[model samples]
Target: MIRQRITATTDPAAVHPGLAEHQSDMIRRCPYLGPSVDRGLTVWSAYDAEPGDQPGLFALLVETAEELRTARRESGPLACRNIAILDPEDSESARKIMQWPAWLARNLYAPVQLMVGRFWTGVELDDSKGRAMMPPPVSFFSLRNAIPSKDGLFLSEKLPEIMAILEQGPGDDGRDVFAEPLGRRVDDPASVYRELKGLFPPPSLATAG
Candidate 1:
């Protein structure tokens, strides 16, 4: 199974020097996320209009080229409509937000404000030369909505409410927050994001005519 590696940075030049001049080579050298092998490069970068400040960026290295193609096919017209142009600043933001428990804590309270992101994907070579040096192409989608956001409450105020809610039982309000059957709740990494952040419901699959 392939997974994406997300990172955040305040400075891209420091992290990956000469990024502007050597986009492809430099990007390929970015640290490998883990045991999972990434197939294609899909990147998104979001920027703020305020000067002297950096834009938040995110990069998504998907599982396989074939898998990415399948994703586009499933996307239908969405693939054409949703694309973005990525820059260094945007890369840094993505790296920062992925910093583990701290990110969870911060986002649980006040959600960070963000604009729609520009999307990108790698373009595999079409010739017999193979995919030695592929170019990244820009595309757009409303993927920003899929990203989790802050819930607009101070940490101090939110913790107690969350704790209290966790303690409640079906007897309290006739609603079972823990109603899933034991077997049904077994470890599902696929739903982990939904479990953790509770945002960005899965895309709606199109129905056959």
Candidate 2:
């Protein structure tokens, strides 16, 4: 768990070097999370912010990407995963969290995948693209009131699972099982983001109707 602790940060740059430059395009692609993701692409109090789970989540994924980067260096090529973690529909507070997949891609430049019933576990660590990549399993460890600051999002209980996955790396025997009852696979976060924006629409627009 040292990785999780030490890696934890409220900074966007800490996760990836390209964060700032691509942030605008990312926001444009996933405008639903535009304001939240556009917190200037700098460090901030992600843990304490309301709906506050953004930064911490960023940190974890940042570390995960680092691990994959390392694996790629050591092992020839790497596949990336692009997964989305949809918040429970009833949860207005957690709703925006769903856009995180797009934000992560903009920053990490990796694909994300989701394993249904697994909360939001999605990934794409594969060699299909002939590049070093990892399965995009977006595991969403549920936190009933997990609003980032609530600290519920970072419960110790789920650390082991995350750590285990980190240790397993990509293309493991246990992956298929872990990915049981798969949900959606988001190849194009931008298009998906636009589609979602239309399907869900803004609260302001919904009310006007």
All candidates' lDDT scores?
A: 0.26, 0.30
Any idea how many clashes model 1 has? 18
Least accurate 10 contiguous residues by lDDT in model 2: 142-151
Q: How big is the RMSD of model 2?
A: 18.0
lDDT of 1 by residue, 23-121 (tens): 445235423211111332233232222121111111221111123334445542122112222322343332233222122222221121111222223
TM-scores for candidates 1 onward, in order: 0.19, 0.26
Q: Report how far off residue 21 is in candidate 1 (Å).
A: 3.0
lDDT of 2 by residue, 56-132 (tens): 44444444444444433444222222222333223343334534532332212211221111122223322222343
Question: Candidate 2: deviation at residue 74, Å?
Answer: 1.3
